[model samples]
Target: MKLYKEKLLSELQLKRLGEHQYSCSSCSYLDKFLQPYWNWLVSKVPLWLAPNLITIVGLILNIVTALILVWYSPNAKDGAPRWACALCGIGLFAYQSLDAIDGKQARRTGTANPLGELFDHGCDSISTVFVALSACIAVQLGNHPGWMFFQCFCAITLFYCAHWQTYVSGTLRFGRVDVTEAQVTIMLILAISAIFGPDIWSTKIPGTVMEMKTFLMITACGIAAFVAQANISVIFTGGIGKNGSSVAGTSVLSPIIPFSMILVPAFIIYQKSTEHVYENHPALYILAFGLVAAKVTNRLVVAHMTKSEMDYTDLSLIGPTMLFLNQYFSTFITEYYVLWLCLVWVTLDLLRYCYQICTEICDYLHVELFRIPHTGNTNTKRISSTSTSGNTEKNGTNIRNNKPPRSKKK
Candidate 1:
């Protein structure tokens, strides 16, 4: 009767989680210039507003705008209204801004903890799904659905691998061109669609034969490849734990299995549907699978944060399983409708997982989800974002601090 009442964390998981501390490092190309803007913006946030609430608000803004795009161009074949394109850009910028500020807000309000790290990254996992899908639609990439699939799945994989290495090395690393650079690039693409119409992505280059969208796709995938390589380099170089073990003392390669399970099924389901389930509704199709990505990615983040081995059994698999089963049984159920059913199922599953997990974390840690612990200095002076950690925009919000932990008292 009470799904939220379910306990997702075991006693050992709780113990390890209590000992976890956030550690991450980022070297972004634009953090220096953007730091000033973020500092000025957070200064205006009411001290009384909870940091988690700020994160939720930003995620809502992103999801709502992304849904608006989906409603207008569900198939990704049609050109969305110019205003919607611009609105998506605005919404994404709002998300990036608020997300970056929430972590800083946590520190300012004296509330930065493992919960902030977990909460922020959880939102990022979901946001990454929507961000990739919205960008595909903004480019009207429906004509090249395969490329669109590549684009969306590529983003999901990048986010997953980012944390995978974090699990291995006990440090979240960001290259000079990472999440911030990617978000800004997509925002610029959305803005271009708004100004010149989605057709701009279809235009031919001046001297080359490559279409603008193809060019963009090549560039995005190339950068993703580079980032993924960086992650793998860390993995191959060995973990920070004893005998090159991951932080959890698990096999460095163990994470690959769980991530592949989520991804491989999506590909098989998409390719096997005789009813053209994906072609008819690319956005919905990806949203279904994307939620699955979000679910597992969150688990990986939790695994890293808790420094515990992850159990790969997830309820979100029910969604893709429904689709797989429907196709295997001679399409007893129409795939288009099954896709819808799948989307609804995954959404609820993700919600259920997050609710149960967050409740457990909050209770065990004695933390509040949407309220600051100590209320005072309704308008206290905030830290200068410029001098603070430059990579604060990566994890869930931004780059996490990489400073070594203070030695515990004897």
Candidate 2:
């Protein structure tokens, strides 16, 4: 079956990185000043280790850190333990360090490949959910459900948008203000929270009822909006106007399908967690964030590999729209029932898209998704293996036909 494209092309054919120089223009000054230290740390990692392995280790560390937070701080009310927060901070620092060095390591080892790029981005997606949920627990934002969801949504949306910029411009353009910068800043916040105590973020602003979480979420929203707009401007105006490439068009409402599947369930799950049955287990909310995070990541990865322009329609747009509308009608109708109906419709649509994308990728690559090697050598092997075996068999049969068969019979 023909998938999005035919004829398996090597990664070289799909090259998008011009000059192949990896630089983060929007990197925070913190990362910039610390570059020497990060370089020193990368130099220490043994040359024998694969960059992809380093990425996997970073992903594992992130998961472990998140698990520790959930175990220690089940409820936002109980507050995260000092030790737990410290452990998370350490893990975040380590993950960030490793993530940074992997590319350098790959370049040093001469193993830089498309698979490594895909692996790194995929892990980043998963880590986004874990880190966001951990932040919610650390800050006890679970008690403030809206803020908790908002943080997760904002973080995930920003992460996806960064990659979407790459899909549009054929280069990963880090905005003058970017997520990598925010990530380091967040690490600082985590460290501060660990040192001061979980209640630090909960402290009220002077002369106002709003807490730190509110201020932070609002600020995060502003940053996310700016970053998103910057990307959209590039996609619609700068890149497309120059190149004449446009994203695949679908019905206006179709873009909402995958997003609703994610956010609708998110609202339901958040509401249910607030109820008595799930109140103590706020990890349920984290799981909800994971669903949306995975969906966004999946979309980004597909766009990157297929080299297709991603539709500008994103869940981040719909989320705030629904959030605002919910406020006006919240008292008049049972939101749960409305969410339940949305849940059913969204789940069906999401599943359908997931199946289509998965199958298309598998068919296109002709390799197990997980088994695709970092080097494009696997494609070379598949293309030649059959011919190599056929030549061997043909040679053997000829030998038999000439005289080898008679010798065997005797």
Candidate 3:
């Protein structure tokens, strides 16, 4: 706790945060078709249920199911049980349904704010890593680590680039076949694995000598490359901010340094390892690096919303640096143990950053994290810091407005 004594957001950033609005342009073909279903699903949720609760629950479900798969096939090369794959499919579907409705729940309850957007995207950055990992395991992609590395990093890169574009243009853009399609395809792949077995992915294509899994990997990687290029092109075409800068009024290309710091070091460590560290423990290696990537992505989201420049330097870099230096020491410590230490370090760092940032935001907005301040009934006295400070500020554009009820004359 002492580590987070300093404020993460500056006064200027906090002031500009109120001016931020969530602007998204999604041309998702699948989501367009599923609109009515998503609307109907959210309608079933009770009024008292908190939006952040909905999001966290979905994220937990996704993580738990993915972990179940990891427990069985830690290396991704081992074939997982049929039941586990089926369970993962169900869990992913639940997560998708619940994640889709949190925003609606917030709006319905009059608790819509920048916090909701930040929380939602923060959940997504982590979820992307798990989702990609689970898909790789489902296809038994561990046998081919080269493809596995490309596939997992490709997914991560595309996710980062999407938000990078948002940081530049001040609007999130989605093409026709984006996240929704990829998720649905993965869900189906898991379902097929559960039914026909993981070995089915090794079968040759109907008319071609290529394996089924290879085709899948190649196609997904190609699509990811195309999308990432599109994002960079949007950045190159210039931004929507003043003087063609990012939403934070910084140079549009500035984000490249932070992200490259992550990807470049990861590639170097993976290739230069004398003990074949990543090849021996693929899942653990990916998860550690994935968490680091997620942390950086979350910072990018915050910078865009706060209209503040994102610092390329981060404490999370300590994890990668430790590994890189360990390899340089000529086997001073077993690489496996070092990888585990790296994972633990990055995880705690992520949690700490999230806690401090959310605490600061909640205090500033006079709102609670998961609870809606009840103001309709006078006798319904819910006493807490959030409730007491509910009347702090109700005029801000993107901040929540907590209002008490008016009295009636007899």
Candidate 4:
């Protein structure tokens, strides 16, 4: 009888062990791939001097580079003091490295935060503006036409808008692993070519085919515009019909909106791509025309909303109305810097609100907003083991030792 009881208990324990083994394997797959690298880095570096410090270092380097570019602008006219340019290049390279290192360090230390993400993106935006401005200054000193300043300004503005659209839509992505590295290589080639003149490369390759820098810039702009528009469309569509009203009408308008957003930028890209010739592509022209019409319609809707009275208690309604009014006033009357600063503050506040909403949703669903390591599996195992032990004790006590011995009568 004791032998049978022991065999039964052993079987139950084996089954429980098997279940746990399966659960642990399934739960740890993702962590398994990353854990080795993470552990190695954590062992090497103190937590206090990890990712955040890298970000700060990157920010300082970028700021110094911007300042140097501004200071060296006058001397850039005699073809930018080679040493200053070299320093700027070195700073840019360092900035990129630190940018990459911060994320790596964060992953290694398992210390990523929402605030870190926000700060990283915000700093990147600021860095882009500084870098573009510096480049504009250098170009101006290089005897380029004053109009090139406007071109650079427009290019930078479009790039920022595209980046923001993707970020807000939750498709914010980086191409540093491939495209950015390739771009750096291309820039190196361009710097070398610039020193020797475009004529040197033009001789080896046909002049028409070898518009290297122009082609590269235009291609980059085109790709960025395309991706931005695609992601924006996805976001707009997803948000549609979520509020009280059906977004059917809005949905109908969505396909045309992105085209309008990219129209001017697309035209600029095409013109640059084709070397400033006005080659009429009917489809592109229609796309440009459609964008203008959409913009006009959007403005009309805004004007209508602003002119109407809205109940203050309806915060959702009032908020949008206030935003429209602010936008209108800022565009027509307010100092540009003041308007921009206000807008930035508002954007940040809105992001904070959205994050709170997401947190609430995750809580309601009983799921994590971001991955939490091992907690779920650990809890499940603890519960299972406790329950199994309780069942075994209950069954063991219920068994009558004298009754069990009666089986030996056969």
lDDT of each: 0.80, 0.55, 0.80, 0.36
Q: How close is every model to the real structure, measured as TM-score?
A: 0.91, 0.67, 0.91, 0.43
lDDT of 2 by residue, 315-367 (tens): 43343234235545542434443333343443344445555544443343343
Q: List where candidate 4 sits over 4 angstroms from the true fold.
A: 1-47, 74-78, 136-147, 166-168, 174-217, 238-410
Candidate 2 matches the true fold with a TM-score of: 0.67
Candidate 3 lDDT, 41-125, residue by residue in tens: 8899998888889988988999999999999998998999999999998888888888777766765776666676778788888
lDDT of 4 by residue, 1-410 (tens): 33111121133322332222100001112223333554454356555454546655776786586556556553223344445455555665566555544544544434343323333444454455445444434333223333333434443444443332322222223321222343254345435534653333223235476444345446545655654565456445433233511122232233334333434443443344332211222212222222232222222221111221111121112222332344445433332333234334434443444355335333322323334334234422322222222112121111011001000000
Tens-place lDDT per residue, model 1, 1-410, is 76333567887887677667566565666665687798888899988788789989999999999899989999998999999999999999998888878766765666655666777889889999999999999999988878888889989888888888888998777777888888899899999999999998888999999999999988987888898889899987859888898999988998988778878888888788788888888999999998998899899888887788887677778888898899899999999988888889989988988887888877776667898656553332231222144234443234333221110000
Alpha carbon lDDT at 186, candidate 3: 90
List candidate 2 stretches off by more than 4 Å. 1-28, 205-210, 238-244, 247-257, 268-281, 308-410
Displacement of the residue 219 alpha carbon in candidate 4, Å: 3.9
Stretches of candidate 1 off by over 4 Å are 1-5, 374-410
Q: In model 1, what is the error at residue 26, expressed in angstroms?
A: 1.1
Candidate 3: list runs displaced more than 4 Å.
1-5, 376-410
Model 1's alpha-carbon lDDT is 0.80
